[model samples]
Target: MWVERYGPKNIKDMVGNEETRISFLNWLKDWKKGSKPAILIGPPGTGKTTLVHLAADELGYNLIELNASDVRTKDKMTQKLGPTLSTHSLFNGKSLIFLDEVDGMYYRQDRGGIEFVQELIDSGRVPLVMAANIEDDKKVIKLIRKSKVFRFRRVVPRLVELYIEDILKKDVAKLSKESIRLIVREAKGDMRAAINTAQSLAGLSTEELSSVVSSRNLAYSLKESFEAFFNADSQEEAYKALIASKVPPRDKVKIAYLSVINSGLKGDTLIKALEKIGEADKIVNMIGTTQEWRLLRYLDRLLAYSLFNTLPKGSVSYSEEDMPWNLKVRMWNEGKVLKDIGGRLSKFLHISSREAVSIFMPYLLVVIGKEKKSLERFIRLLGLGESALKVMVKESERVFLKVR
Candidate 1:
């Protein structure tokens, strides 16, 4: 959300954390592999995620990200990611592996998880990143010993004041020096928290600001996916977002193609969109096999399509909610289930997703009602109860009534 709003496309828009950001960028640019991963440790809301994404985004490197909850089992890490380490690059040259929140990973039943990840580091894939808050744990200290550690200090009040003043222009806060000092005091130098607190307080009257911070309730904004596809500041950022989205590259291409078409793109715009997706498909195909993992950089091209392929100016207005993430996730999962069903039937007949949809589905509908046992798992995954199944498949309220 902040990137779409406040992010600097280049180096100039950056506010604080100058020294660390610069050093990090320089390290990525100069990497020769075989080097240990780098760690960025900072307090919360200090743009640690943003910084990692920004660095990779600016550099055009593919990012494979893992967070704390990701299956960090010893067997899983070695068995799966083990090859990516020694094999090839995702993008022609090198790709970045980002393991955020590693400070929290120390000891467990799977004590070998951290040890195995270190083994991959020896294989020379490229740079790896780990981020955390308060690097006090013994495990974190051990990991820090293996990598260059960059500290992101809290943004000072004067720097925060400058940044906010530059953006908002007018004094939205309109506070006396005393109140400003109190806010600064309360902020503890985290500019992001301060900015957020200010945004929430802006809508409140003088009486409301005295109570508490309602702003800390802000959720991590969902705009990263959109910005990744629509207006990423850097090629690296765009590519990393697309890869991290976990949607297949082909589907990503298809979605972008449809978005452009839906935007009422025509003539040369239509021509360009088609060409872009065509190139996107080629890139996807190559990246799918290259193991060099280059399809990531091509994401910028996809995002460019989304950003420029909007409905022509004055042709259509826009709203904040194009579609909710929850709804999209559901439909996407449904589509996948449909694909799985289709794939099963396609294998039976030796054909494609299209063939299954066009031909096999009709047969299933007839036989499915009689022998509905096969559909139990899919129906459950779809969260469809007996009534929903009857309504959708049977079109018979009577069937539902009988079951009830």
Candidate 2:
């Protein structure tokens, strides 16, 4: 929550990446129809997505944002983003389309997603911005070919500490210099993680603080989880390690799969490990579909006893695959807003909230923008306050651009 609470309000307020931020702003400012879309590549917590949102707001552009969690099937991408790319804004303001975590797409889950995006970039009437942590990913490489790519580096420790200090001051919270330094170092140049760590340390006694920081440092990393599973000398050891792991079961399966492939397990061993991983993946999917949380208890055993046993006994180090805290916080806030809007619109339109969002809202926004009398009437009827009505009008202007 602190990540969102203290997120930069404008482009100039963003910490670190000053030159890259300026370049990004200039890219937006000088953008014309059919200009190459810019891809902002960086490590997690480096403010890539934040830069796009802030720049759009400050420059008076209507922002249309999509994330990896959204359905990225070709049809879905085309349906949701195609019009926004082709049309001009009704209010004469520019529109910026932001796609976050483009590297997360895969051939199976996001069939044709990259191709569709490439098509859009070639012909889009507005600038498109995308963020990815892995710039060299095959899919990302393809996107980069058609994009003006900017690499965002990690925030230096000193800057992260200063940012944390500013936030703590605002909250009237106190922390020792040593404690702050430890947090910044532990965060490894991740500003969001550093802030979150500081927030947890707030109000703790000196004695409690040291222990807490120690425990946080001991918390399992993804690489360590892989090592534990592969290097376990016994089934019990593997089970204990897997159970104690902080990585979610779904991600554990992915890590195991990647480890097996990367470990050079050959012929029968490779086939067997992949089979077990596939089975574990199925269990994960089943758990998700049924909400049968009890099944989760078996996942660690399946992964450890069956899949990991196939691997040679040694450590396997892999990069962390967890979603960044900043993005998680942003998505949480965005989801809440969408849910509220859907509920309000559904109640007024006598339709399901899902229908209100997927079917009615697009047309409704255009109508609201084009017909001021109707907008006023709807505002009064829906009990939308002046500020809310203004937001609606602003969003509607973007919708009208697409519809027109």
TM-score list, all predictions? 0.46, 0.54
lDDT of 1 by residue, 1-404 (tens): 43246544565566678898889888888887677778899887566777778778788876777777777778766665556566655436556888888876766844787886676556556688889887888778877888888899887778766665554444434643444545555566776666665565555666676444334222112233544445555555555555455445566666666555445556876676567677777778777787757557656556554434533433322224345446677667656655665665566678997798666666555545445565565456555566444433542233444545
Clashing pairs in 1: 57-236, 57-237, 89-292, 90-292, 90-293, 90-294, 91-292, 91-293, 91-294
lDDT of each: 0.63, 0.80
Highest lDDT scorer: 2
Could you tell me how far off, in angstroms, the CA of residue 176 lies in candidate 2 after the best superposition? 0.9
Model 2 deviation from the true structure expressed as Cα RMSD, one decimal place: 21.1
lDDT of 1: 0.63
* Alpha carbon deviation, residue 327, candidate 2 (Å): 39
Roughly what TM-score does model 2 have, to 2 decimal places? Answer: 0.54
For residues 1-404, could you state the per-residue lDDT of candidate 2 as single tens digits?
77788877877667889899999999999998768999999999998999999899888888988898898889998888767654566545678888899998878989888777877788767789999999779989988988998999999999998899899888898998878988897788888888888888886988899888677666666776667767788988888777776778888888777666655456887788789989999999999999999989899888777866676676344534354445567667655655666788888789998898778878777655677778778767766566555656666887877767
The TM-score of candidate 1 is 0.46
What are the per-model numbers of colliding residue pairs?
9, 0
RMSD of 1: 20.6
